[model samples]
Target: MEIALVGAGAAAVGLLDALATTSLARVRPGLITVFEPSPHLWRGRPYGPDLDTVLVNAPPAIMSIRHGDPGHYAAWLGESGAAHLDDLLGQPLVPRHRYGDYLAATAEAALRTLRANGWRTRIARARVTGVERRGDRLAVVAADGGRYAADQVALCVGGGEPRDLYSLAAAPGYVHEPYPLARTLAPIPADARVAVLGSGLTAVDVVVSLAARGHTGPITMLSRSGLLPHVWQRPSGHRPAHVTAERVATAHREHGTVPLGHLIGLLRAELAEAGEDFDAFAADLLAAGTEDPVRRLRRQLRSVGDPRIGRRVLQETAHTVGPYAWRLLPESGRARLRRHFRLATSVASPMVPVNAATLLRLLDAGRLTLVPDVRAVEATGGGFAVTAGDSAIHVDAVVNAVNPPPQAVPRAAGELVASLVSGGLAAFHPAGGVVPADPRVQVAGDLAGGGPFITSGIPGIAAQAARTADAMLTLARDESSEAPATLR
Candidate 1:
């Protein structure tokens, strides 16, 4: 059997590692080909040198690729003496580079194991341009005119490049898209005024890098919402004492299924019924509900209108439900959870303001500036012209921090749902971004309803890869079982 895996980022690595460790390595696919354009296969753009300050927001314990080994990553850190195991687990942040190294090491180990077993594994250092279905097999075409046939395929392509800066065709300033920060930050005049486009984690990393490099120039971080990420804080142990199946069932019965927005109402009802302080109850509930206390707190903030109420919910949930609260949602509940996210963004939480403190500190220190919004830009004088919101700011460099367009897989495995849909072999998902398949693991990661698969974080990407691998293995096994005796 020929198995093809697309992209060599964290997800791909996880899949490969899982395959290496499993019995499937011996009984299944004769050859495994991985399509990755980067020179460093396991370490993709996120872990590159340009993003030194990019930190993993998850605790090391929950960040490992190995299934059922919650403390694997933390143990790795402790054994390596990178830091004390307690310090590593106690803190809410881990350096992005360390995580990158861990992934690389894991991939290397898997590769060695595969080689030792005499299994054929190939890494194609070229871009995959298209995928086509050919009878019982699939054809993966490379941009450079090469092709590979696979009995199965896995599309694990990582995030696309950063979005363009603005609508202008050409501008004098540099519009950085996947631009190397080391190159951009080196040898700059200390008094230069730099404007960063987004206020998310990417913008934060850039701003923090600039400050660390002794750039005294005024930097402006502009965005649609102008909101930055909240600082990493150690979660305290506090939980809501109330949270029973009866309470949840009661809320669902009364509201006909509660959305996250109704969390406030549910809490209020519970409080009134129990005759207790809502804040105290919420604190205990959240603490008991979530393993990641900080994330639990964030979820509460996301559920309510009042900042105090949100904080209390998060604190209580963290103490009561543990980390499983977020994971315990059923598929229908998950869909509702996604909907609640869209609604929660409108109401400003007190915690939302905390997102900007780092940037604000830089502005106050005169190390960053808020540039006037640009209206238009035109090429002129052999350079480019830029219009701010109301003023014109001309510069030699500009970076586009906008989010990238969605990605599409040119080809998919012979039995993979995405491949079938792209090849007109299957139907598309109702939501449009997914290929129709088993709803649990077969996600669409393309613009047309497939998914980029993972989000913008390491933990998310790792989890997606693991889930995908499990699904693919299961599918392959079921197919093999139903095949002719000779084929099996």
Candidate 2:
């Protein structure tokens, strides 16, 4: 049997690791091919060392390739003895490069194990242009006119491409992509006025990078809300105990509405009753829930009246949900929750003080300027014209911090995603993200009802890979008695 995996990001790495560690002596594939444009397969954009300011939003302990091993990443850090881990875990913030190194190391270890297991591994250093079903097999065409046939294909492409700004693109002093931040901003003068389009995590990274590089210029960040990511806070020991299925059902039974907030209060009360560590409890709940608890709470709120009950349900869901889901809460919900919770919440970075302090220091020293808005950009005689609301400002260069549209896959990894969608092999999820065959892994990074999956984050992606490998192995065992269907 032969297997092909595309886009060697976190998901692909996890899959490879699973294949290497599993008891595959009886059902191992004859060959495994990994398609990636990068020199290295596992170290995609997120783990690449190109940008120093791109920190992992999650803590090291929760960021590992293994499932049910919360401390795997932290343990690896200790064994590697990387000096930065101490500072990273010590302070509220950790450098992004360190995390990249961790991923690289993890990939290397997996590769070594695979080689020892006698599995033939091939890393194709080229772009995969398209994939098509050919009889019972899959055909992967490369940009350089090469092709590979596999029994199955798994697409683990990363995020989509950066968006293009018409005004910014035509302008003489505009920076389009922010990934290669140094190269994009290299031509700008040290003291230049700049405006960032978005105020999310990417925007913050750009700002932090500029400061580190000693770019003493007026910098203005613009967005719909102009809200930055919240900072990470010290773990609070406030576990809630009322998260049992029985309690949840009872609450639903008694009151027509499960006020999310009230549910949270009950959970907190239950945690206090159980006497479990708050941090551990919170992590466990987040790791378990597949759906967005907040959204569920909201739906329950609308279905049932009783203002008090509604508040309780919302609170409970909010306390138990993961950061990614919590971040999806409506802006109003976020604001209300912030006022009630004193503990470290993931709505935004809890370490905003550090980020705010850095930005304020730059502004007070005339190193940055606050711009009203980015009105328009046009080519000027020598440089570019930047309009801020009503006023026009001239600058030698401008960096676009606005996030690109969800399409236009970025890097080599996203090509397979585009192919899958265009081929009708996958469909988009109503609520952001591509659906995969398995919820744990995404197949072609598109939301379609099929197996061989891909996921958004490391934890989920890792889980998906392991699950896929297990499924494939099971199929391999069954193949001895039954003929498996091939791509028609």
Candidate 3:
């Protein structure tokens, strides 16, 4: 049997670790090749060493490389002596590069195991260009004119092209990409006025990175609502009164999908049960028209007393129902959720306290300007002029701090995803992702051109990895029994 995993991001790491250990001895694939476009395995853009202080959003325990060993990553940190950093804060968020190193080490361990079992394994440092089905086997083509035959192909390609606010392709000093911040912004003058175009997690990364690089000039973070993400407190062991798994299941059974109305009602019920008013809690978290919305939220949570419980209460509730809601909801329902996702994210996806604190420090020092209601950013002869509402500010440089571009898209999913869709091997679904691709070819992570329903957080991603491993094992076992003697 031959199994192929495409792309070497977090999803690829999870799949590779699982597939390496679970194959039955008889059914162990003769060859397992990983096609990774990046220079190294495991460290994708997010976890790559783009910035010095860009710490991981999740801690070690939750950011496990493999699903079965949930504590493996945290343990690896302790054994590697990297845990010393956590001494400052009892439970510390790891540096992004540290997580990348962990991934590389995990990949090394997995390769050793597969080699010991006499399973031929190789990492092809090239992007998979195409996947074409021929007879019972599949042909995996790489960009560098190499082809490998695999009984199964798993597309773990990450997201597609980024969602951009403006088309700055022709503008000088207009940077639409955010990674390799150390390199991208290296040419800017120290006192150059800079403008960043977003205010989410990625924006925090830009601000932190600039500060670390000793960029002393004023940096403006421009956005609508002008609200920074709230900071995360240590999570509490609290369960919701109304937004339980049982309730989600009930909603699915009764409504065919988790109705948007029912989901909202469940949230309101949870607030009422806790003697909290839903409107008040939301107002405090989504407090816009203020210079420091994030600080206001932190203060509000503290005022509630037992801040951890108060902060995590709504986040936990939304996450609990999210998977069910995404899978079961129709187009209209998903649309409804998307409309409020940013607001939901303000509470559901808070920045790590460290990043938030850094932002506050920068703000207090008057080094960072938070611009509200960004209308347009047009290229000027000298630089880019940003128009926010009726006001305008020209900056020498513009750094797009929006979400990173998706790794693949349907139309421009390069050769691999395009081949799969064009050859009828897969079909795209905004909510459902690619329709299972093929029964034999399991597509992990996001499959659609844009937003996918797959859970991307650590716990959910690890769980999905485990499931993919089991599926690979079952498929390998069945295929080995029927494969020709040459394949075996």
Candidate 4:
């Protein structure tokens, strides 16, 4: 096929898996090129191997790279000499790097199998600087002046560059990149107060990392809603009694791309069927002040099951239709979703049990504070001045813990997309990033607008890769059929 898979991250892993197992190979010749300059294969920066207090919000149960093999990572943990920790495998969240270990191991094993099965695969230890159409093929040009010709290019560039919370590029004590190869936080004095922007899981990771490293000084996490992420409980696989895939399909058939509000109504109905409601949950999520809404939510989680059960049902429903739903929506519906998506997703991506426990412990000890949101950040004589809703605080360091905004445009990817779009091989989605003009050029990953399905996590990536590959294979079939017959 002479396929070029750019960006060997989780999305690439998904594509590799698809190529390795699917019958699509019957339609094309076999030669795959992977471009990644990272030291290791599949562990993208987020999953890079490192010893840190940061933990993946998802549990080991759902961490497998293989689509149908849910227990792949759990089994790998037992076989990879970490069997002693098997007791915690069922529900506890493990270190983030363990996922890197799983991914790298999975990639190595899969690549070996592919080679043994008579498939040729090559790795390019460089970055794909840009993609330009050269005659009949797309040229994946590397920064090292290397160019690879491909019948098709699958752009799996992961999430784009992070959006900075403040313009503190030159400000002292401002920790812009919280997750770094080396910890810049160790230099901060133990007694120095800090302000953390955003109260999502990213903020939780930063706070947990600081608290574990003996940073006893106060930390105030500021976010727009002042709501912390929901707590994870044991997962329930049973379909929510009310909100099922059939219901979503039915809603779509009736409403023609269900509005975000009506989808919320469906979710509320599911919760009600499950003997729960979103009244309290909504109150906490919509709360606009320094009060910790998650505190009340956590108490409820301890008493009842995780609030994410209803969310899981709705998320599963979204899996069936969300990718096209976003595009199908009226401008008003899109606006509503864009306005509240983060707040809604915060509850969907829950914090691990231990993270919630650690956060509450810090809060109880008065070392952590959750504020409404950061209004502004400015440089002060000592460090940075952060203004929350009503109070102003100056801290020794300001850590921006906000994750990339939804549908963020990749900083470096802009050039590549521009090249492709200018060449009429791709289209940029106004909601977010680039979309492939033809199935020959595929875009897969967290920046989901370019493909048929949108997703960020491992499962979504795997499915998106498979879908993109299948679509590409279909296009390849057409291309092959149309090629002129020749005798050489």
* Best candidate (score: TM-score): 4
Q: Write the per-residue lDDT of candidate 1 for residues 1-488, one digit (tens) a residue.
A: 67777677776777777777766732555788888877776766666555444555444544676654556666766655344222412443445666777778888888788767766888898877656777767777777889899766676665455656465335545556534567666645556656677655566667776777777766766654443343333333323334533455565677665444455555575455545577675454334322332343344334333323333344333322312233334456456544533122212111222233445567656666544344554545544456666666655445555545434322322233344466663455443333433211233122224332123233334445565667767767777788888886
| Model 3 spans with C-alpha error above 4 angstroms | 21-28, 79-90, 237-255, 261-310, 313-321, 404-412, 430-433, 448-455, 480-488
Ten-residue segment with the worst summed lDDT in candidate 4? 81-90
Q: Candidate 4 local accuracy as lDDT?
A: 0.70
- Candidates 1 and 2 compared: the better one by TM-score is 2
Show where candidate 2 strays beyond 4 Å: 22-26, 51-54, 79-82, 85-94, 236-357, 363-366, 369-395, 404-408, 411-424, 428-433, 436-455, 480-488
- Candidate 1: deviation at residue 388, Å? 6.7
Model 4 residue runs over 4 Å out of place are: 79-90, 240-256, 259-291, 304-308, 315-321, 450-455, 481-488
Query: What local lDDT does model 3 show for residue 134?
Result: 85
Ranking by TM-score: 4, 3, 2, 1
Q: Rate the local accuracy (lDDT) of all candidates.
A: 0.53, 0.56, 0.70, 0.70
Steric clashes per prediction: 61, 52, 6, 1
What alpha-carbon RMSD in Å does predicted model 4 have with respect to the real structure? 3.4
The predicted structure with the larger lDDT, 1 or 4, is 4
Instruction: Order the candidates by lDDT, highest first.
Output: 3, 4, 2, 1
Model 4 pairs whose backbones collide: 1-29
RMSD (CA, Å), candidate 3 to true, equals 3.7
